[model samples]
Target: MAEKGMWPVYGHNTAVHLLQRTLPSPLADNSSQRGFGGPRHAYLFVGAQGIGKSTLAQVYAQALLCTEPSDRPCGVCRSCRLIRSGNHPDFRLVAPVNREGAVDRSAGLLRVEQAATIIRDSILSPLEGRYKIFLLQDMQQANESFANKLLKTLEEPPAHVILLLTATERTQLLPTIVSRCQVREMQPIAPTVIEQALGQHWQAEPKQAQLLARLAGGRLGWAVTQLHNAKFDAERQEQLETLWRLAAANRIQRLAFSEQTAAKGSQPQLFNMLEMWTTWWRDVLLAQANCIDACSNIDLREEITRQAAHLSQESVQKYIQTLKRIEGYLHHTTNTRMALDVLLLQLPQIV
Candidate 1:
């Protein structure tokens, strides 16, 4: 269950304030108004992954249906509880699914059939709640056909129907669809603010919170998730180990590793691993400059320092550039095997 009171959000306070203000005020005169308040029929939440865009959207949906007059979502009312428990009669969430019916991170795709269902469902009156909400997660994953189907609904939505769409970036969506909704761009939270929230609100230990805050890259949701997810740390450690190994690997060995990674068919995971390598090289550059404390991989200062001495600053910087180029191509139309092979060849061998 979500924490009681106002929405339980940590970072992106500005976006939170906008949502609180734009959402229907619960204190309106009941006799004069039929519902809580009039809210925009369509909203597009734009932000990076793990930035709490979906969390804010759900909280706003609760506000649209909560019966309390002063505090919306009272987090205690029948409507609030139903929504939280995923038993709300009028709430619908559409997301991409794999063959097993679970969310697929690497190859997520929202089909046109799902959009058609949403369009058909939007015309009906709410069965229980005051408003009906249709939230589409990862709208960027929707194909051209899906976008066209959804666009029709956004163009002329029912008064009681609220459409919420979340995406990593606005450019990933069609301009016509974007124009039909109110866009809310969420920014990353400051490290200090995240650290303070972890310690005071989440009750995290001081040292752990500080480390998470620094490593989260201004993403509070990511930091908070790390606290509860033991596997997150393990995976990160594995990535760091892979980075150290790759730096010392010869051409034949690196090519073999690349071949194995490309066979996994998990492009997103591979991209993330490469991104970590990029960050590691950047840290090495900082170590070479004697600014080891400023590195994102703060826990690996001694290792970075030792590796920095084996390679010149020019090699470290160039490898960082190469990793970024590879990342850019992988996101689009590029051969994964070919790209990874090139990337492996560029890794500097230790002296």
Candidate 2:
């Protein structure tokens, strides 16, 4: 049970330690009375996806509910056991259900009903532990109604109740709700930390791990996803090589490739491809600027190096700006076919 709060699944040790430091220190005689007078009613953890926000929420919950705490929750205690088995009467995790009205396994957004449940349950006294913990992940996805329902609980929480809400977009949350909680902003993992963690935990092939780490943009979850996504890897490699070849030949192949890639699958996949290309080109830009650390195309560093030799810094900057414009157009939900065509035509002009 105590192991549940150990946050072993997370690779960001520094973030975990930071969160731990926020706990009431056992060494302090007044530690028990610190922060909201021994128990907090609510907290907000703001960070990007895969930055261990959810995991941190759970860890804090464990520390709050742990019967035996020695700097951290003792996994062997009753409170820890209940949390581990997901049978902690005092601990509840509110998340969005799937279309089938089932709890989504993939950490769905919070819905109005889920918020209502938390509100209702939070008003009651804990049946087991001294504290009741509610963990709400992806709070930004909560609709207005859901947010409103949650706000009710935040305004008047029961004794010994704690609400932990996590969001990638903190501003999306209502200001009223934000004002009631202690907000903690989690930083993105550094590339070096991510690289080292991946090597230690996944034992990923060195070259592949390095490339994935760079491409993940300091998101360990995304890096792991890319490592496992064989299809995306194959397609990404193929598309990159095609673009490199066309650029090397100084040909206008952008429109054709964009159209072809857009037609390959759904709009989401097309956007993903566009994002991939953006990152790839950005790496080329960084390489041109002699900013080795800024490059994310480690796997294609050789190709980028070769291309940088012939491409001027101004050209890379122009392409990056063009890509940003294309992204903006996509954000406007521009017609995919037209957007692809226009972006494709503009690609060659940048070169």
Can you write out model 1's per-residue Cα lDDT over 1-351, one digit (the tens) per residue? 123444667666567666666555545432224344456788999887777788888888888778773435677888878888878889988888665657774577888888889989988988876578988999888888999999888988877788999998898899999999889998887788888988988899998888888777777777888888778778889998987787788888899998899888788779768867877888889889988888877777888899999999998888999998988788776578899999989888885
Q: How high a TM-score does candidate 1 get?
A: 0.88
Across residues 112-190, which tens digit of lDDT does each residue of candidate 2 receive? 7787778778778788766778988778767788899888888877666788888876687899989999888877777
Which candidate has the top score in lDDT?
1
Please estimate how well model 1 matches the true structure, expressed as its whole-model Cα lDDT. Answer: 0.81
Worst 10 residues of 2 by lDDT: 27-36
Clashing pairs in 2: 1-80, 1-81, 2-75
Model 1, 278: alpha-carbon shift in Å?
A: 2.8
Candidates in order, TM-scores: namely: 0.88, 0.77
**Candidate 2: TM-score?**
0.77
